[model samples]
Target: MRPVGLALIALAALIPLFWFAPLAASRDPVALFSQYLGTAALIVMGINQFLATRVPGLELVFGPLDRIYVLHKWLGIIAMVGLGLHDIIDADMDGLRGGPLADAAEDIGEVSLYGLLILVLASVITFIPYHLWKWSHRLIGVFFFMGAFHYFFIEKPFANADPLGLYVSAFCILGLVSYVWMSVLRPLAPRGHAYKVASVRHINGLTEVLLEPRGRGLKHVAGQFAFLSVMGGGLTEEHPFTLSAAPRDDRSLRFTIKDLGDYTSRLYRELKVGMEATVSGPYGNFSMPSGRDPQVWIAAGVGITPFLAFAQTLKHRESGPIKLYYCVRERGDIPYVADLQHLAEETGKLELMIVNSLEGVRLTPERIVEDLKGDLRNAHVFFCGPAPLRKTLKNSLVLKGLRASRFHFEEFQMRTGIGLGRLAVWLWDRGIYAIEKRRAEKTQPAE
Candidate 1:
């Protein structure tokens, strides 16, 4: 399995070990384990807060920002499970209850657990409105504060100044600081590049936003994305959008956004020229492959944004004979086709293929091999598209003689989950398809 920020996991695991080391000889094993569970869970919660801070260079400890968010979600789930188990076992030491303060701490812990449950539910349930979810998410630190208070004040098997106690206190302070920096200080004093909207255009179902820098701008490679916080026109939330244009000296940026969600719809309808926006990134690891290798570039719908930058950066005709497959619902749905076509014709290196799914044109692995008509042993394949399309094409192409190592793609998703909504439907569909295929083969004449 890929590393889900193993640093955090190791820290959480080790803390419990340290806490349980001296107490291993204690006769009350049940209570000891309960205390262990609570300590581990609280540590995990602290790690989650740090992950959410999105501090620069954190991608080194964690993976990319996208993967960090995914890890954050899972850590939240694990922390909740640990907390629940701790509560179920009733975390209490034998004959060590301090009077009134312990009672209040216990009450505080209960309240924090319930609060976290509601907030985590709000986060995981996809149907919740994004704005409301964001609002609930910001309040998580308050409950974390309560939890830290409980940890300090409650009657425990060890003194507050002991090694484990100091460690937990350190985590609590770090988590709280991270929380305050991200949700409180960052908003009042932004850390991103300042820019003003130079232009805004609506093309078909997409919105192209052009931003000119107000001061020093974000320096980023093509295909990397940045979080945009537009100031006015009912757009208060910050959202990540990929820069569609290549990097330039002037530092102006272009974001080609599709009107798919509430925020994007509002941006498309209400955003005006001259509106101020803050760009909080220069994030993601997605970029063009280096060196001279015959390449296959595939994009679907708005997935074409990153490839637009890729196309713009192709300066030398000798660098590549890159074959670009632009998959669209219809030919008319794209506004950048002419730009790509012009570039291809000028360079004599890039080949543009538009696959219109509305027509009967489907891009399959067979088609790719036929078009190449050569050995695929050293070819690099880069793709950005819907998950289903990526899965189908990646698996099929690998079977059809493409090197698994040569195939490249980025997960690039921010709000991934445990697939609670589509898991059942997907399993059902796969089962039905298999049964029908088997039945059809049985009924057919022997081939």
Candidate 2:
């Protein structure tokens, strides 16, 4: 993420320099810089599409998908700011005011600009239900395609024989294609295998989604996730979930989902055996690194899912002295406790420590540092959990002389909640509790 993000930033910063710097003296400097800003924004938006595509070459090196999301967000913001500056400084309204044709074109451009602003803002708002936002966001394609028309027609270069126009036009075209591929084609894309539901097990308030692949199975490292869109139960949209087990020889995948939203909460009832779904991407870089030092693995709630995959990988490798701190709000929230415990015992050097937050086990970094055999700097610390827990632990550990490089974790933004201010809070809070309903005495075990 660092290298690719920085490169994109650099390119966004440099395009204006390379393209507009030479024309600065010949044209009105203000108008020239305004056009430059618009052009830079267009370039950034083009880059935006590529990043969103989840190309393995880029993501494998540049990101885990979470950081890419944050980066993708910032690029959109930068583009909007640039376009705003362009509109302000290059106000050609006086000319447009005199001509009806010019006025119509100018109005269209204004609409496109504002439309993009709303689209980007909608995405930033965590309160908006992801489903509504996901569908509405598709309208950006219309605005974007029209923007390309606006660009080609209004930019003096393309209509007036400027060579730089070609590149800008190319970017706009590419951006349009990318948006279509992602918004329309991706869900049905053949690269993602079709899977039939093998079983749905509701355990400890979480739904274990086990999928049996219909054809070629997804090849992924442990600790990775994929986007799954079930055809049944009104689940037409693709949602991301982590693979909880190492790739089974039978090629089945498991997702232990806690109801975090409208869709997930009902999945147990709606999704059933023989139902179909599409699986795209084996994304994320949450896997363990090569070296075997005294490793400290920490997990909170459902965040422990990835580490469960990692534990399976440990079976075949030369293992290290590892300590897993699995913390949950309560014991019932724990998923695969027996399996994870078995992995710990089987690994010989790995130990599992279950911390029930309900019972008052505080997982402070200071406590962790003291528990380990050597200096904190020597241990490779990998954490998976809620953002608050990761943040608190990371801050304390880094402050207490742990090398920042030794730490690893993904961003844990709560993104699944549906719609509006305090209502969003109400929905999300209950949505979580609703998923974690205590199982009844009469419920059957996994069949």
Candidate 3:
């Protein structure tokens, strides 16, 4: 029922064609396979560039922008690994013609491979600062350009007229075009609706930015999100945030951003009213079901943003009985509590339930089913939360009477790594913290 990324599937399907052409040039399978890998890696790199462009209608193809990013990350890793193998395998054809251009291309190829390997390492090691990581990521296009040059000039088994050469050349062009569009052209001509900050509110460690359109505004479904770039207070990077408020007559937008990272913390401290902002999108399909079916909404922490938008819109739209569960660590952590409570009372079709985990209360599937009066046969369950909680609830609910399809969450966006990388980061953080504490203790005056 979910999108498996049609573009990725098509790439996989086309890979065998790379193997077919290079086989004629060499009887040794190792050399031929390496050539196939080189070509395939180029194609993957091209598509990877395309995916990073943040072009409209990509969510339709890739499911969600977050998922598209996830795919982009993996594809890049695969391309790097594939190219690494291709280089190491020594796929050079015997008695190939050489020249100054070929010699330069060979040297460039080596540099590009090592450069890509370093960039790939930077990507995998997630602890790097975002700005640095982003800057390093931009240099990938340079390497891609160099790699393209190397591909064309270097002595290889196939001629330029060959099918393999032509096919790989097409992808190289695609990558170059995408790179130019994103890095060179897109910045000069910005995308998205221009707006000025109408108001800024800090509540419960979250920054709520209200923006009013300077010209034409954005139109969006209640549950969709937008990428916002605040042009003032030293903030220029675009970050995705869900529109917490429903679309209004004035066409103003509201983004409830948590101060979780460096950019957000800076924005929270520095962003002011009347500062200009640009917002692009209305992306994602994570909206309410169209049909008037009973629904159970589960939200944890800041995951309540979309649900808040949904509740605000419920006055106009007709829907079946909806039981909304707001899960939080403590009472103070709940955002828009009074608004949600008012909405529940104002709309007789809605019910609000608060689950406080800090008070030793857990929102288990059993509790949800019990609250629903043991009927999940007809109710759709929509959730936004931590990945582990989602997994636990989904698996437990499916074990019960709830159908697997009925339990829906932004699975790709909420994915957790397989623990190893996360564990290493956790250990690294603890070690740094302990070292800092000991240093501070030594510097302190003793009685």
Q: How far does residue 260 in candidate 3 sit from its true spot (Å)?
A: 0.8
Q: Flag the better candidate by TM-score, 2 or 3.
A: 3
The TM-score of predicted model 1 comes to 0.89
Per-residue lDDT for 71-165 in model 2, tens only? 87778888889888988897342222232354465677788899998988888777778779877777877777766666655634223245576
Decide which is better by lDDT, 1 or 3: 1
Range of the 10 consecutive residues with the lowest summed lDDT in candidate 2: 91-100
Best by TM-score: 1
- lDDT, candidate 1, at 131: 76
Residue-level lDDT for 247 in candidate 2 = 83
Report the Cα lDDT for residue 347, model 1.
76
* Candidate 2 off by > 4 Å: 91-102, 155-161, 331-333, 414-447
Top candidate on lDDT is 1
Q: What is the lDDT of residue 117 in candidate 1?
A: 86
**How far off is residue 447 in model 2, in Å?**
82
Tens digits of lDDT, candidate 1, 109-213:
999999998888778887787878888899999999998888888888887788888888777888899899888898888579999999998888999999999
**Candidate 3 residues 370-429, lDDT tens each?**
888888788899998788888899898888888888887764242223355878889999
Minimal lDDT window, size 10, model 1:
1-10
